[model samples]
Target: MVIAVPAVALFCAYATASVTRHLRVRSTGFDLGIFEQGIRGYAGWGAPTAPLKGPGVHLLGDHFHPILVLLVPFYRLFPGPSTLLIAQAALLAVSAVPVTRLAIRRFGTRGGSAIGAAYGLSWGMQRAVGFDFHEICFAVPLLAFSLECLVDRRWAAAVAWAAPLILVKEDLPATVAAVGGYLILHGRRRLGGATVCGAVAAGLLIVEVLIPAFNAAHTYGYASGSAPLSGLPQKLLTVLMVLLPTGFLAVRSPILLLALPTLGWRFWSANPSYWGTEFHYSAVLMPIVFVAMLDSPPARSRRWLPAWCLAFAALLTTMLPLHALADPGTWRPDRAATATRAALHRIPDGATVAADNRLAPQLTARCEVYLFPFYPSAALRPTWVAIPDAPSNDPRSVAAREALPSLGYRPAASGEGVLLFTRSPDR
Candidate 1:
């Protein structure tokens, strides 16, 4: 009851914010739309073909995540991008359960509730919820419960919980291997050895074989372009940020070693986005660090640790999206947002649309949507193009608009700064 109550409360809070963002057209197609397209395919008993990726890009080609099939049932029941948003909220909120239960065992009920609430509102979880959905949301809870099981000395359940992570994403195999390494250190040699070997093999097979097999180029798309040493300063700062909420106490526990694989890959990646304290990338690490804090067991004199962590999280929330919930203005759509939505409705159902990044999610449920300047084929150009009227400094947006006239589209609808173009029937 202690855990469930707080978890549910977080769910409602997260769901309200995420769903509100979608309603106000703040969601982007690159993620929310793309993910919805993939799930939509799954619900129809077809491959997770997200046209938003390209003409017929199998999403598995882009990333190995068969675990997404689990959402197909829920998406089928309540179809649309909001379903994914709500599901992400629930997944992230539920992760606090194992972390909270473990904390309650270590501390008393009040301390446990504080730590749980802190975990739920931690900056990592806040960034993930504020941003769009990602497969990493599933990893958050899986890592928490698996670590909790490890804390309880339930070896089989720990392995069972951690094993599915590879199916969540290729990079997660390394995390799985780290869990196995923990088992080995704890004297569960045989189980740990099997786990490490299985995780390595699965990671290699998926990254080298499965993803390449489905990828349009017949190779792993993200196999190269990383410079691990290129961003030393930013990477170090991010590590500090991850530890700050725990007042750096989590480092005392060996379980903090679990964070290595995730941090390793992100730091090694060339993308700067992975290196910073942004997006859904770090949500999985919150549980590991918080659990490690509990395992370290502060001295009785330092019983204020959990409360301090909660205070830090609460302090940071003012800079995060959750702060919007306290403001009355967030509930009302701005004039531009309302006008943009009105313009989007001008496009017909089932028509192909090359949509602006922000406009894509609004039409994803009803239209065959693609990101502007990139569609399936030149031979099958989108019948409608939707974009904001205000000048875009983006080179792609500039180039796409320049080519619109030559590609045979004319103005069909216009709102404040929103514009919709339709291709001529003769063309």
Candidate 2:
């Protein structure tokens, strides 16, 4: 009951925040729309092609996450972006189960519940729920359970749980390799060696062969040249932040090593986004660190740790996305959002629409949506374009808005900073 209650409470909290974000039109096309397109394809038993990425772009080429097909049946019953949002919330919330159960087995029920609540509200999971959905949601629970099995010394079950991680994302093989290393350290040499070798081979095969084969350019799309050595301080700060929730005691346990492969790639990547504490990148790391803290020598001796974690997480929540729940503005859409939604409704079903990033997810369920200013070539130009009339800092958006008239598009609907345009009759 302790485990189930906290998990259910967390689920309700996460689901409400995510669905509200979607309702307020705060979701973006780059992710929600892209994934919806791919998952919708899967729901219909077709290729996972996401036109929002670019016409006929196979999502598998962009990232190897066939595991998303698992959501198809659920999507069929309730079709929309909110489905993905709520599903992600559930996936992340349920991860607290194993973490809490393990803690209870070590600590008492009250102490276990505190630790579970802290893990549920950890900054990493909060940030992931605030952001749009990603393939990482599946990994969060898998890591939690696999690590739980590891702590219990259930070798076969741990390997079984970790094996499917590779199908979740291309980079997860590194995590799988780390799990294998942990097994070897525990003296399961033969099993651990096979796991490490298999993970390495699978990662190479997926990135070097599979992704490229499906890619339009026949090369890995995310192969940014090299890792930059700049920003060492910021990267180190991120590492420190990950440990702080656990009061830094996680460092004593070898189980903390599981987090290194994930941290390593993110810090080494040329992309700065991966280096930060923001977004879904850190969601997977929360479980690893908390579990390590459980295994740490201090966990038993220092009963105060759970209270500290709970207090810290509570303080942090006041500043995170869930904080919006306390604000009056979050409950109702403002005039701009209402008007933008009105303009979006003017777009007919099945038509191709070039929409602003913020408005794209709104129309994706009923329309073929594309990101404005980056729409396809003239012959393939979207039949409609919708953007906010309010000034944008992005130069491309500014130029695209100015060029709309000259490009033979006329305002079909306009109000409260929202504009919807369509091709002129004679054009």
Candidate 3:
């Protein structure tokens, strides 16, 4: 466990620094703005921060995540989206603590620490770190901590920790129910049955009763929206992505069954996006697989398994783009990045602004920001606009770039492959 702390600390620091650099370089894929704005709203500091996730959608409507409220106070002190990134890093690293403790109890300090290091460096965790913050940061560590409690027979603590996942996302209820199933199988019948019932009740209440109650769109995003039979190859590949780091040994343990909830949802859904290993969708599965690996020791037990796990992680870490996130150089500024910053300076404080996904977070702190197309320009009547050229321009940005001039917004400035447009003063 000792090595786990420092290793996780370093991992968190790397992620925090990388995200800071991402911000400076005008890389907005990290979702810093979406969360920064949302948390800011929860803190009562801004005109409800609107994330650019979906059109005509409230931030709450994007996902039934009240967990954003928890981060409000931290953001109050630090007051940047980077705070969320750093918090996410710290929270994600924490899953290693309980996991390391479990390994230590079974394998002794040295061996357990090695396993913990592998868990800390798992591809899903690393990818999520590079991908930026997600609410799953809370869920990952909570799952680890709660599962550890279950392993140690601390039923109350496990239930307490496991219950809050309902606030994380729509899909977590099933994951929580699986945790109850684990308990029931292990002979804790009452707690197990109770947890299952509570999880189901909470999940239903949130999705069916609570969230849809306030959603502007009057809908919630529970399914992956996948069409029939198309996602099989992607599903198969995603399964490989989950187990390849541990040499596919995570499958041996019954604890690995916990991943089925998330896996089934992702694979069956029509959302082709969920079929890939990128993003935060698979974040919770990492700890499950890794912990299961620790629980089901190899026959030889001569350090072979742990060593192989670490080596496999190291090789993949070197090859993946996420490894680039560990370098401060990844955050260094470029022309388009600088130009976007300069364009922001031209817009007045508190003016309504519309921006592409990558540029929205930068403007969230000072402006009343709206994500383009999602919040129509006619209603937003934004005084200023920023559009990153080419790749960052999703359909919304393309439409805005074409429509802005006709809407009486003319070019204010252009830089970093982004065009800055302002509504004509006379209008």
Candidate 4:
């Protein structure tokens, strides 16, 4: 049954993308195109997405996520938008191996299998797998394995697993340090001290030096506004989302402290995107919470507790947007997707094209793709431009549609609310 978990996750994730909608590609430029474009740059192609990122945005410079460089070889081998999506599924699924072991140690085979099922079916993992591709995919497994090692008291392995976290994202060093802190509090002073020191130093260096040096913007740059934070109510609610799924069992372990930095970053973010239950930002928290639950069950009072928690978790996912996408009624085929496909077919291979956020991922493999508002497209002078007839608030599409003619583009084709524009020469 544990063997079947990854397959189910992969199928559900792949199906969600193919069926309900390409939520990953369709959203405003959150991060997939950025990663794909960055990987293309890392793989030695030009970085056209840099212009939309802002002036002088190198791949590592843009977000300080150097981990994408590791994907270069994979991209070289299999260059396409789905590469990241499939890679993300595998990464999330593989975390279950260690989680399964943790459960086995706590309870005998049958009970352990139940724990593993719960861990795999948990709302967070399901939501994350369906959430398109994200760098957090890497973080999720690493954090999950690290916590598993910590729970089993595999000190060396724990440190080793946690060490690579610095490369995942700038904010993760704080989680690493929290792991070290937990170790120290548990009486492993030597290893714990080293972990804390290294994580803090590396984190500071990345944020203050490496990131600024790479970025043309020359600052941490995430601040979307001047408001410090919305308030405690949102913070409390955000914390509730993490705890409620596991019946608050996760709080029973020291590992719960590991979530603070990530939670803090979101609740305190000036950008409202970080403040909500949506997106893959919280995927990393899922494994930590589940592993902590494995630790929560006392020998006598807890045989049934894990099962109850698992049931609740599996139940919770039904209400989540991810699993809900599997419903045929909710998924009803998308007409715009057909139109988007037709419009994308018109662009020839390897030509530069500016497309809307939704269409950008599809065109990225063959074209040097960029987001619209043409000027910011790194002066590639896109040979073609595609704009979805998006709603008023989708500024990228709306702006691209209105701006094309002024920039000397002519409407060459129209279908299912998609408008394709081309230069006079191409026409």
Candidate 5:
């Protein structure tokens, strides 16, 4: 089962890569902007503020964990957005190995394989992998590896395992905290060391946050801007969407319940925009559930359960890409990306442009870029402004647009649901 599933996943990844390559010529979902920005940031040419952001925070060119930084030179060597898509696809597919190992460690080999296969082929994973090279894909394996080490009672191993996950994204600090707490409470002494490791992780996170916050304040002259704080209801809904699958499995299979909150909290608090858009993060909890489900069942029932679960996952996975193909807007290809990419190219390179969407910063690397929820001291300076078209059409977009010019910007270039403006050189 393990061999077959990954073999199938490799084939799927290859096919996905082919499709992405063909589509790359068109205005497409695979945005090279971020990757390009990242490469330039590594080369010390693009905005320094970008490296201070989410996944970019941890990049080390080729010197450090070559795995995470591998994309840097890969993009530099390949010089196209499709390279990023291909890399992401490959990572998602390879992540199946660790995920399968984690599942086997908990449930047994077959159950582990089933969970891994489902995850590898999920539409959400495919789409995310195809679209952008976010840190989430890289984090998945490290998180899984950490869990495997934790479950094995290898505290040193787990700490080593989790380091990469923690480094990949800022939010991962919370995940490390939760998992470390679980380890400590469960009577793992080495968890004491893990806790210390987590504390160090926390400190590093604080630095990442503080650096950006401080910079934003100094540069923009504000500590932070008000975006709608997701109200309690919205927060609750976000939690539910992130945890629904785990919740479903937990009810049917109770032993897996502990892992639900352990892993679910990460999803629940995850950036709301992440919901429905990137499924891989949500799928991260699957191995935990699969292991618990497969382990707790009676021997006879266990035999077929893994198969059934895999079958269900397989069916869903097959349907997602087809659905995406049938309705590009609803599925794999987002129109927003195409429209945004097109708009980015129209703006002159090296022109300063302020934007609400992070995509613009990455795509318009030749231009000076500023992202709102503006951090004050970003190393990059804005000379021009760009706002999402029809900001008033929605509250969030409106808030984003209104916030942009308040920092001293005025309109310059506008079209196709996007607006660009130049910042007053005097200011």
Candidate 6:
């Protein structure tokens, strides 16, 4: 079963990669940048020097997944973004094996297989795993292990297993709290200890919030400022779509009676700001629901629910190839990378550059770069600025151009809506 999981994951990953590859050559830049960042961070090079910013350490970012940090050393040795991405894909797929085991423990082997397949091929899982270097990919396996331990009533083991999850993303502490609360409420005594451990794990989360805050304060000269939260609704819709299959089964399954409320509370209370930014954080709870639903006593009327879900998923996967071309943005990495590299080559080595928020890190990896909105302590002023053509008409872009003179910056070069700026010594 374990061996089969990787095979299945590899197949799905390849399929996703194939689709994404065609979306645009540059879309892969984010994934590649993440891998590059990991490799650089691991090697003690290109990592953000300020110690705590972005996904590696902040609110809506991941910080606790030690596996990724550990992977850094090995990544340094191996040295290729594609290699890490493939490995991540394999691990994400292999997580289904334990999920299957948990399902089987709750349901029969056949039912467990169905649940495992659903989880393994879940859109959320597929999208996340398909990406090159998300920390969530590593956390998913550990989360599955924690659930397995919980089901076995091994509270100590569960808590210990969940330790790595805390580091993977900041919001995970809330998940730990949720699971720990469930254990304690269910009259599991050792769960008290686990709850305490989870609380301790949460203490580590301060780094996520604090580091970002510090960076914003020190670099941007403000403790807080507004960034667009435009995608919250879309993110929520995506979550609903991803969970539709499991949600349908939950409604019909008695064993999952508690899950409906749990899931509802989770989604309802979620911070709107975090919705789209880190949607993958929801992966941890997915298997628990799958296990509960599968384990429930047979409902004669609803026996076909799992089959229906699988059939629906199969249909979607089949049709994905047809729509692939229409969704150019789906090929994000390749397109983004090509664009970024082109922009990079035009900038002199060590030239300070600022990029669109999406492209900033990629550019940062290739050269000295800063984020727009101008961080006050950014290591250097940008001589070139890269903006996506699509967003050039945005108010922020206009505001940035307006603000440049005030900040002692002048436009130097322009390409495809991206502008390069040089600091004017006579500001």
Residue 46 lDDT in candidate 2 = 97
lDDT tens digits, residue span 1-427, model 1: 9878779989998999998888888999979999998888899899988877788999999999999999998998898899999999999999999998988888779888889999999999999998888999899999999999888889889999999999999999999999999999999999999999999999999999999999999898887988799889999999999999988988998889999999999998998988999888889999999998888586771478778988999999999978879889887757767777777877888899988888889888888888886642357679999888888888977887888777888888776677888888976
Give the range of the ten consecutive residues with the poorest summed lDDT in model 4: 18-27
Q: Per-residue lDDT for 90-115 in model 4, tens only?
A: 77777777777777777766667666
For every candidate, C-alpha RMSD to the true structure in Å = 1.5, 1.5, 2.8, 3.3, 7.5, 6.2
lDDT of 5 by residue, 1-427 (tens): 5644763665465446534533433322123454445555554544323422432342332112224455666766765545655665665566566556655655676666766666565444555544445556666656656665655667777677666655564545555665666566667757655665765566454445544443433232222333334344654564443334332443454334434443443334435543333434554554445434433445565456556656665666555542344445443665555675677676677665555554453443465444533421235446655555653555656665566556556776666566766556665
lDDT of 4 at 362: 71
Colliding residue pairs in candidate 4: none
Tens-place lDDT per residue, model 6, 42-145, is 56654423111332222222233334556666666765455565666666776777767766555556665666776765655655544435676766777677
Evaluate model 1: give its TM-score: 0.97
Candidate 1: clashing pairs of residues: 389-417
In order, the Cα lDDT scores of the candidates are 0.88, 0.88, 0.74, 0.71, 0.52, 0.54
Weakest 10 consecutive residues of candidate 1 by summed lDDT = 372-381
Error of 6 at 19 (Å): 10
Model 3: ten consecutive residues of lowest lDDT = 47-56
Candidate 4 C-alpha error for residue 295, in Å: 1.5
Candidate numbers sorted by TM-score from highest down: 1, 2, 3, 4, 6, 5
Deviating ranges (above 4 Å) for candidate 3? 1-4, 24-26, 45-56, 223-228, 325-328, 331-339, 373-376, 389-399
- The count of residue-pair clashes in candidate 4 stands at 0
Worst 10 residues of 2 by lDDT: 295-304
Candidate 1 regions exceeding 4 Å error are: 333-336, 375-379
